[model samples]
Target chain A: MDYISRYLAWLGDGIRDWLLNADDTGHKFALMLVAIILFVVVMGAVLLAVDRPKRVPRWLVTVGFVGPALLMLTFGLVYPGLRTLWASLFDRRGQNFIGLDNYILAFTQSEFQIVLRNTALWVIVVPIAATLIGLVYAVLVDRTRFERVAKTLVFLPMAISMVGASIIWKFVYDYRAVLRNSEGDLIAQQIGLINQLLVWAGLEPQQFLLNTPFNTFFLIAVMVWIQAGFAMTVLSAAIKAIPDDIVEAATLDGLSGAKMFRYITIPSVRPALVVVVTTIAMGTLKVFDIVRTMTGGNFQTSVVANEFYRQSFVQQNAGLGAALAVILFVLVIPLVIYNIRQLRISEEIR
Target chain B: MTTTPPPVPALVTGGVGDDDAGTQSSRRGLGLDQRAAKAKKRLTSPWASLLAAVIAILWTIPTFGLLITSIRPQSDINRTGWWTFFTNPTVTGANYQEAMFGSQTNLAVYFVNSIVITLPSVVIPITLALLAAYAFAWIEFKGRNVLFVAVFALQVVPIQVTLIPLLTQYVTWGLAGSFWTVWLSHSIFALPLAIFLLHNFMKDIPPSLIEAARVDGAGHVKIFFQVLLPLLVPAIASFAIFQFLWVWNDLLVALTFAGGTRNVAPLTVRVAELSGTRGADWHLLSAGAFISMIVPVVVFLALQRYFVRGLLAGSVKG
Candidate 1:
């Protein structure tokens, strides 16, 4: 027993050192190779054990297949999820139990109230705006010669990271304070496209990301930009899926253009439209990157997701962060449930 | 939540079983193809085409601006809008050169780290989920439905709820601030969704196929490896691409576990940090942003058919 324990310790240390202590690119990639080999060996062993000629118990076979995933989920997700929930009940340091205090503060405090408001604003605005744009674009481009290229143009953003997308928009929203010559003539050229457009219209250039409440809208626009592609893809497929007979019937009834779209196209894609809006809402609810990259949640632009990160990692307020995380989790539940329910109904109809 | 409920869009529409969805793509397009011809006869709405053109431009110009700016010289980028690049063409590789190899922002190192982190993260989760998914789909045991449902429900647990505690545990295990931590955490987070999706795919396999293998006295492991895996290649590819893009483009998990260290921090974290600290340096920011985007964009464009299939499966019922 003593030898076994000692050998296990030695093996663990050696593996850890090999995987973690290596710093160079060669060593890191070597580490990846080692991981793959190790995974293959372990899974091979498990399969061999289950494949013995002697009859194996059903439960043992199940365990051999399922144990590893369940073990990982237990340690990594389930146990920690419960712990975070428990920690949210305590104070900032997560020591003293101050039940619901963090939750109360999150709801009542002026700062967090703004966070909630910004989140609500994002959830409502991004999905509707992106979906409307995507749906309209899908209808227009349906079966067109340039449909592929046109769809790709809008859908490209979904391929880029939120961080990258944020950088792009941040450049678009880039502000250089207006400068004047001695004669009071405008001297500074607007670097940002948005402000440049405003200048072209003979309007004062506004700081799109610095203004309160409205700044949140600018951040939300970034999300809508990224997600509109997803909406377009899903809705485009749905539009195409509208039954031929139904469209033929609508066409026979003299329904054309807006009337065809309003009656046939809209009704046919309603299920998909619901799924797209709710999925985008769920995604929008958890969007921290745009806010983090654009404003760093400054100027009252924080959402629940960003605030969770700021509290837990930045401020080291585990309790408050956990509370915020819980709030995010709670917020996502209804959306998921609704999404699944809609999918089931859609599936049944199919 | 209901018992044995389907998982969220990340799974249902995760594009995992998209091969099944791709075959139906032609059928879905049938209605619209016919509608286009009839609609042309009624009234040609030039306004619709114009609106779509405007929307396409709106969607594209931001990225286009960044792309143009990334190549311009530092002075040009700072002094003027990227739109002016056409008239005053002064392109330089210096920004790309510096953003990649320069000190204080050696994105070259982070780019390697993203690759190293993403490969194992995608591979490990898919392998484990394949086995687990096979078990859920084929193996009959007590509590099987319950266990499968539990895994499905786990998808709804926001990753934020698990980060801090998992980090503490990683620290306790002496794995904190390592690629192992990022890889392990990503794999773990990816498991529930992976299992749910693969299981859905496996369940769709004809039961007679499995029964035939069973009648031949082949074991479960053999059947999984020999019979199902071949059929599941498309499914695996779909999820692999999805997870690959996800882990590569991810910022939060990498940021939390790897921090700002060069050894383990991926491109997203480093690029995000650059945006914060060097927000004014469009030369570096634009270059850095593209450095991160190039791989995913290429992958997406190449495999867009499969991606759309997976997406359609998730949203529109297969």
Candidate 2:
């Protein structure tokens, strides 16, 4: 056993040294090769194990189904969750038991207050804006001639991931110093499209992403843009599900346009509207990619999720970070429960 | 809550047409007059439909800018508005070429890595969740409802809370910076939702079919493959698309588990890198965005029917 431990230690040290000194391209190629080999070996073992003549027992099959999944969840999810929860009660280095001190700091600290406030703003604003726009769009394009075209165009943003969306919008918020030609006329100053358009309209090009409250709104617009399609698709189906006879009866009673929508359509689609609001709210709680990609959490635009990453990883304050994570979890649980209940009620109605 | 009396008798009686019908028609006529009065009321109000259209157009501007930016040259991108490219029109393939071939940054490698991470990240979760969902739905077991609810409750726990512990575990297990680590992380995060969704779908499958298979010589495994699996195509496809999109577009798990190595970094991380180290290269970033979008768009368009149908099934039914 001692011999084996020494050999393993020696092998690990050798590999670490090689990794440290090796050229980047060579190391990457080597890593890819190893990954492929590992995949082949693991898959081969599984295939071989399952190929036996005697039928794999039901229990074995059950284990096979649940084992890897359980193992993964234990290590990747449950263990980490418990560890973080425990860590949250400790100090920065996770050495001393600080109890609710970190939690108190999280609520009392000014930066954390901003994060909480911004998160609330996101939850309140983005969902309402996105859902309203989506509900309206769904109603408008319900039976329109260009419904498919319009919906596909609108849904196009949903197809782009948050990272991709951020990259796309980063250019929209790009900035550059003004430049002039030899003639001293503003020859061509390029930056963000909004800034460029401002220049074109003979107004001063202002920094869009750096402004505090307005920048928060600008960021929320990105989320609203991406989520509208999701809301539209779900709500459109709910709208479609309203019985035709009820609509006809309402029409016959001379309840037309907005009145019919208010009395009939909105009530019928209330469950779906709840689902949309809660889902978007829950999604807002996990929003880190956009902040990370676009602003790197700069200019006082950071939310709890981004700050969690920054605190834990960048600043190496595990306790405070874990405290933030718990706060986010607390925020999300109610929305998730509400969503689940809404789903259950909808299902029961169906 | 106000408890209104059930209107079943009123509904039934309202169907009869007689002397009351004349009164009802007159009332309806009065309502029509009121609607006309409301129309007059709305003539002076804001055009809500026009406002909606304006909002939709406003929402699309960023995307329009991205499309134009992808086609323009870096010089032009740095020099003028993307809108100006419509008038000047000096498009270049340099950004696309660089993104695909990797001049300074090897984005193509990250794209391939994304495929590696996503395919299994999608397939493994769906496969495992299908079996688990089948068990939860059909197989009589102790603690089934408790287990299902537990899994469902797991969705509420933020992934950030688990990141550090997961990272430490991966390092301890010697799985850090490996493809397996990312795949495993994604599958773990994705499984609760997948199982929840699939269980809902599987519960809707008629029980008689499973009993009929049991009446024959079929075992659970055989029944799962021959009968239940084929019937689960729509559910599987829907879950597959959701999982695929989640994995493909994932940045957090990939960033944490795969580390910063170019070989392991997915397209999301690669695109993120373009902003920091390659900030001035908006042209490359835009083209990279388009390239990364191609797979998801194709996946969505190809399976859009299944996607829509599955959402309806998952949401409306269970």
Candidate 3:
């Protein structure tokens, strides 16, 4: 351990010296900047060349069109995915193969089960609640007096980054047990807003983010608050797409109110509903920010993404983290496939 | 089966005219009935509107608290609910001053870093996706369907799987901790969805318009810029908002590659530091959080209409 620390410090010092001394790092960095600019220039040129009379050579077009995309995916995505999968089958140091032992451990561990359950709960609750709230808001605000204003207000949370949102909510959940007045009288003041309100209502100030199951729910509320605006916009468009003539026909048949919605409205907007639900579901499956920011996945609130980060980076148990990542990939792929298929089908109908 | 012709032409025309007037009166009565129905809807379902209002308020509570905390003194914040500041009215800009200038971790510098990262991230993907979208929509090519499907399928691969391998690759390439690495990664991750969305919108352009341009010797480039790009303003604007918000808010990639390093770290990473190391400083955090939120809020508000139009444009069309 002493040797490792000494080596790391030495390496850090060496890198620092190199960085300070070398003019090439700056030059190379500048060249990279120029390359990025040239990349744009070359794309524009290729776009212009391809649009010309004879059409740029088919080979040039193909290379121009597909080269960057293929390179990016291979280097950035495919390679990483394959490497992670391979690492999952190895030991913590990634030197020896263990062949599914990590997977077995993941299944058997109580904490892993809790993570899975909490993830499932998040996937189930956040998407549904967000979609429903958004749909209802869309319906209420559709063609109303305050449509733009209401939407702008609700969508405000989406602008805040997850870390920022977490910081904001942390203060909302801020708790300090001890307090004193200038006179030095002891006061049991709860700093968190919800707890203060609880106390005001003549109840005990509860630790909202410390409790197990309820804490998970509390964390989910933050995501729902952020996502509901997205749902509202998508679902609102779907609602608007319901043809007026069909609605008028229903009214003619005296099928007013709830009956009209059941028979005509929902069926008309099924495609949008599928898109909204699946999009939210896919997002929920990889939820990391709220969990990471609020509790750091403590107190039985860890999901797969957060746990994967902890095990791989913090704990340096790369094998288990890779296994969890593989599981996440498996869960997300089917949803992506379904979403694409749905998109294609919707296009075909159009 | 033949029915007998009972009426003469004069009587048929006269009777039709009389019925038209009668129907007009009855339609007026129907209009009154519609008004009554609308009134009943408002009266009976008052709870629906009330419920929406309540939910909106509930949703805004956390953000409201943060805004209040940003204005309160650190002593007041540590000792009381932000709501207490509402009644007591002991507001101060000291936290904002401290968050901005007092700390070694300068948030303003981080904000500039975020802008530098975000602009390129938005620009690169949109530019690449525009070409790809044009090809997918208009140009005929071999294996197009398979390629599109593959790209779409790439969306399913969780980002966690790619982080380490990409990091190792960046290290080997000597690009790790560089802005280009983060920019390229953001662009790559954003590209698949961008192509899928932009292609959907591009397909909505009338085929005849492109065919006309092609016949007139307008090349793909000419048509793309002169003909198609203008029409795609709404699409580009909307996707820009999506990509901008995404890259700006992104913490994971920023953490893995550009984290904790001065001169390169983005706002998300900087804001994250406040909580972990300076956890006791609630006032500074609240102020920093608001600062971080400012750009995205402005971006959203400025481009919201385009966002809605773009979403519908992508989804509802081919």
| Candidate with more favorable, higher lDDT: 1 or 3 | 1
Give a tens-digit lDDT track for model 2, residues A1-350.
Answer: 99999999999999765543333555655654555565557644653464332577555655544556566667767888999999999998999999999889988989888888888899899889989988887776554434565666677677678988887777777777666789866765766877777877987766667888778887888898888877777777667556657877887898866887789989988987888887777787789889888888888889999999899988999999999998888888777667766666765676
* Candidate 1: docking tier: medium
Q: Would you list the C-alpha lDDT of every candidate in the order shown?
A: 0.86, 0.73, 0.74
Each candidate's fnat: 0.70, 0.44, 0.48
Write one digit per residue (lDDT tens) for candidate 3, span A1-350: 99999999999988654432222334434544564686789777766665544746765665566666767877788888999999999999899999999999888899899999999999889888998888777767654445556776787776678898788777767665645689964486887787777767876666778876899998998888888876776766566556556777888999855676678767776766677777788888888888887888988899999999999889999899899999998887777667656666665565
TM-score of chain A of 2: 0.84
Q: Could you tell me the lDDT of residue A98 within candidate 2? A: 90
Note the clash tally of each candidate. 2, 0, 2
Interface RMSD of 2: 9.3
* Maximum-TM-score candidate: 1
Which segments of candidate 2 are over 4 A away from where they belong?
A: A1-64, A178-185, A200-202, B1-56, B308-318
Candidate 2 chain A, poorest ten consecutive residues by summed lDDT: A17-26
Model 1, range B9-44, lDDT digits (tens) per residue? 322332311333234545455444454565465336
Error of 2 at A141 (Å): 0.8
**Estimated TM-score per prediction?**
0.94, 0.84, 0.84
Chain A TM-scores in order = 0.95, 0.84, 0.83
Better of 1 and 2 by lDDT: 1
Candidate 3 to truth, TM? 0.84
